[model samples]
Target: MNPVSQSRQSAIFGKRKEPHTVIIARGDQIRHFTVRPWIAAVAGSALAAVAVGYLLATSYLVLRDDLIGATVARQARMQQAYEDRISSLRAQVDRITSRQLLDQQMMEEKVGELISRQQELAARQAKIGPLLDSAADLKTSSDETIPTPAPRPDVRAGLDATTHSTLAGFLPDLRAGSANLSAADNADRLFVSINQSLRSIEADQMDRLKSMTEKAYRTADAISNALEGAGLSIAKGYGTSSVGGPLVPLDQSMQFDAVVDELDEALTALDTVKEKARQLPISNPAPGKQVSSTFGVRKDPLLGTPALHAGMDFRATTGSSVRASGAGTVVTAGWNGGYGRMVEIDHGKGLTTRYAHMSKILVAVGDKIEAGDIVGRVGSTGRSTGPHLHYEVRRDGKPLNPLTFIKAGKAIAGLI
Candidate 1:
């Protein structure tokens, strides 16, 4: 081969395989090192690889720190949101509990008030029971029938149905802290209904008391009229008694108290009349025995001539029982001028009764006696021509018509 061709080939190949030279000189001493082409190439490649690795590592570290910070911030925000939600739920629960407590307290207060009213009504009833019974007696004795009052409402039973049911339905919810405004409103309505019922009962009681008072007044007035017709005054008998007190007006504000006071006064008047009638000579000495002669200006049985006779004569057999006409104390029991084996009784209110012409005297002076008590035996004795009883009535030592008393007694027989 030609030398020129070979040199051209070597030149191409040598350019690629060229070696690198490194030299170091300090002062006059100098050092040099030769590097082969392959060695230099390898060293350059290694340096480039190291530089790329360092850049990659720096970028990874910076990006990793940013990612960690972002993740931590997101987690903190989520935790704050959850905490806010929990706080709101807790506040709602507290409000509901507070409302329930308020409702429960109100219910308790209302119940207490209702119980107080019930107790007051019961006390009033206790006081009025006897008064009503007395009024009923007066009604029975009266000639004219009195109107009966309506039956009273049972306040306790009605209140129990209304108040108890409401409480029972709402109490559990309140205890559980679940009651709301609607439940409270319902309870209020129930309490109002109960109060209304109590008011109605109170009104009924007042009406009944008033009616009883009126009835008592009527009865007392009737008794007074009857006594007046019989020539007797209740006041005359009661006024002389040792009983007196200051008169104080009853308070009108307390309705029940005022009505009760009126009833008491009327009953007192009636009692006075009854006592007067009992003491007076108002009953027949001998029941079922016909009177042979009437009182006042009758002919004497012994003389058979017109004369002033101040007594009635009962046609009865000898030894028949002779009863006192009224309750009294015996004043005379022995024979007087023309009255043999006689008995005279002194009743109160200046009234007296006498039983004369008796076969036997059964009572003595100062002996207490009552109407229908056997005081003598019927017989023809003083100023009599046959077996009979001489009965007489006197007021303040003056003779009164015995028939008048007998009629009055018959009129009031069932009353006093």
Candidate 2:
């Protein structure tokens, strides 16, 4: 056959197609089957679809697990951050609360101190305000003069009236006027101002107390000097006494009163001591008279031997008036063994004075005599060798130098 004719016949008759065959056997049985290409292709497509489905399902499951784990980790990290933030905030809140509490406590303490100061100032004012007013009203030009107190209905009334007067001038009412401030701030300022005022009052009180103390000390010193000049002693005060009782705490106000009372007592003692000094035998018996003999051991003019002379001798004309050294009563007015006419005066406190060698005795027994009063007349009598006045001072029967008494009297010549 020609090639071209064969090719045509192949195309028309489908001679290029091949037959597909399959064989199956089971035990001794056998079977034969025929297969087509289209059928095989269909079967292959179905197998491929199943494999793709399985791969997709596996990928979905893997990806889902990974996403879930990632999500859980992220959420845990966020939760930790949130917890940390919460903890920090809680700590901050605790700190703030503590700070506020401390501030409040401090404010309360300041307020309490201010209140206590106010109470103290009020108490002190109540105690001394009226006295101050009276003193001011009765002030004198001389510092040594004491003024009389004025009568008042009540000291508290004036104190209350004038308590805040200066405060008003110095620190104006913080709440009374319009202010660009919060209420709390305003109130704090007012508390501060009140505290300052209390401090000022305390300072003033201290100053006054210092001045009074100085004055009291000066007065007491003057009195002591005067008393000492007159050979008088002052009594000891309350320093040595003890009291058995519940111990009461004294504040500044009470302490001030105690000081004032002690000063007053000291002044009273001075006055009393001064009065006592006036009654002591510390005056000159024969003023302006010349001394002939001093009180001590000396050579006796008549015996020509050393002897104890217990009295002072004043050289005066015979019949010259002899005066009493101090106020007292005559204990004896008669002739003594070696004294001739003698006069003994008792000045109390176991003290006595004697006028011996007197030409005439003017004071009788039991007679009252005063300083400068005539007790006798100067004369040369008994053991005396010349015209003279014998003066003797004795304490508890023991003789003292008459010159000492004369010197003490001279020291306080002008004073009481």
Candidate 3:
């Protein structure tokens, strides 16, 4: 064998052949790639990749259908939740609307009921008017001249007779029964405690009146009988025939004139007592009034000057409920320029209470108020500085120190 040239041997044995290089595309970059001989030898590689791609596409379509179904189910559940929320909101709205309607209906019904009650009360008052007027006339007549009997009877007898005969002497009193009017009879009928010891005192007075009347009647009869007996004895002894004249009873008449006058005055006093007894003037006491300011002199808050405070102030919070101090019919309830919101209750004994400085009025004129019932709200109104109640007790249209009545009311309220 012969040796090759150095260059040719170097070509055959010194270095291996270079591999084929390929370039791959990358975003803004280049990659070098190399192929192996096995890759070159594989000839069905494209067909295989195409078959795999078709299979993958079919699988993807099936998965897509499942995803769509799942998405639809989820969307339906969400929609149902939204519908439920809307339904709940609609029910809430319906409830609110129903409540508002019911409130309006209830208010209307209450108003109608009140109107009916007022009408019934007015009718009752009308029916009672005639009896009241008759009593008034009797009182007026009694004030006039007394009728003299054919034979002048004792004034006390007439006075005693009136007690049993006339209810004016009896009614309006709460007392136990008597042949003649008794205070206990009146108290029982009226269901009122005029006073703790009132019945006892009235019983004593009635007894005295009856005693006086009986005594006067008996004495007058005795005097008349004596005069008749004397005349009869003198006439029989002398044997004369003539009817006795008014002159014959001169001494008895003269004596009885003063007695009759005394008895008459006494009967007048009794009648006055009866009138007072029959006056069922019950003062319903309530809780003590909380005073905010005092009556008399004070500096005006608005004017910043000294002014004679006509009425006391009662400090209370705004919208604090105002209560009626006594039972009565509401004579007035509305805004008065300086009084702000005010309510006046008329008690039968010529008494009335004025409540002022209210933020809201809850009662109307002619509405009856019970003791300790809410009538309005406390407020700063009508020449005032702060929220407070202005309470005034009046007698015969005159302002009085409300504290006296207020204190008395507190005492009574505690008992009640």
Candidate 4:
């Protein structure tokens, strides 16, 4: 059969169609068959695949950018939180550091004043040495001129190599009854340690102040010892003796006040500081609140008649906790006349505080109560009106207005 006829028969009989092809011819009769349809389709699919791959790359880059932006935002928020906390802590540290600086400054002023005073004392002590020596020579010693014949052999009684220094006056008997203060060596109040610290600092005022105080004490002691060795009392005398002391004339005798003037001033300043520390308020005091009724006067709440109130009436709730105003041992507890179920605390500064009209007592007579400790519940009790705690602050067997101390304490509390 012809090739064209066979091809037509295959088409007619439903045989698979042959692939379409194209041919290209060049000069000299060289020809090439075209690519098959399936091959063309595969090339088209590869081109499409390349295009999709390009889209996918672009999408990935966009997604990566978004992820980076999100991460950056999150980091920024976290950093802000940490920075805020750091700033707050820094502020607190600054405040505490300031307080320490103030305390340091105060201590430094005191120490400087003390050192100045000590120098004055030392000067007077210096003057007294020569004065006392001269006075002793004038009063107790007589100048004797030894008759000098040219080295008489009989006169030389045992005097060979060492010549005895001229005997002056006997040392004064100044050591009598004396109570040496252990703190006499201390020239200034010890500075409290620096409470807050920074990461790095060249110098802190607190440390400097503390050092100065220590130096003042040691220097004073050394000076005192030197004066003592020079045959003169640091003062006219340290302690009193039963024997009268004007053995020499008044004009020549060393003045007692001048030698220890610095010491006296220093002592006065120290006392001022000590008193301030003592008056410092403790934590929540029962007597700190405003007084509804004072201890002594006014008409009775129930009877509406003038009556003597044994203790101050502090108006508070029934369950409000009553605190001890200072650290002390409880000396009295339980019921007493007009002070029902009261607690009395004896703080060693010759001061005592009493809390009365308690609903419940938590401390006994021998118990040690620190300042701001809950000693009992406040309530109305024997010979009293409604629920109110009776509080009293006493000093040296006399009642004082607790308001003044309480107000001062409240002022301090506000600082904290």
Poorly placed runs, candidate 3 (over 4 Å):
1-290, 414-416
Task: List the global CA lDDT of all models.
Answer: 0.76, 0.71, 0.55, 0.55
Model 4, 1-416: lDDT tens per residue? 99999989989899665776676767778676767778989999999999999999999887998989999999999999999999999999999778655544554454454344445445544643443332231222222111111211121222221211110011112112212412211212121111111101112222322333333334333333432342212332222357565565423123334323433433333334333333332334664455678656778777889976654667788988899876788999899877888899887656788888889899988998777889999988876777888877776667766655564444434222
Q: In candidate 2, what are the lDDT values of residues 76-169, reduced to their tens digit?
A: 9999999999999999999977865554555556556655665666666666555454334122345423222222112132222233332234
RMSD of candidates 1 onward, in order: 8.3, 16.7, 40.3, 39.8
TM-score of each: 0.69, 0.47, 0.32, 0.34
Worst 10 residues of 3 by lDDT: 230-239
Candidate 2 similarity to native, TM-score: 0.47
Better of 1 and 3 by TM-score: 1
Worst 10 residues of 1 by lDDT: 144-153
> Model 4: what TM-score?
0.34
Ranking of models by TM-score: 1, 2, 4, 3
How would you encode candidate 3's per-residue C-alpha lDDT over 70-120 as one tens digit per residue? 999999999999999999999999997786555445433433443443444
Best by lDDT: 1
Quantify how close model 3 is to the true structure by its C-alpha RMSD in Å.
40.3
- lDDT, candidate 4, equals 0.55
Candidate 4, residue 299: lDDT: 81
Clashing pairs in 4: none
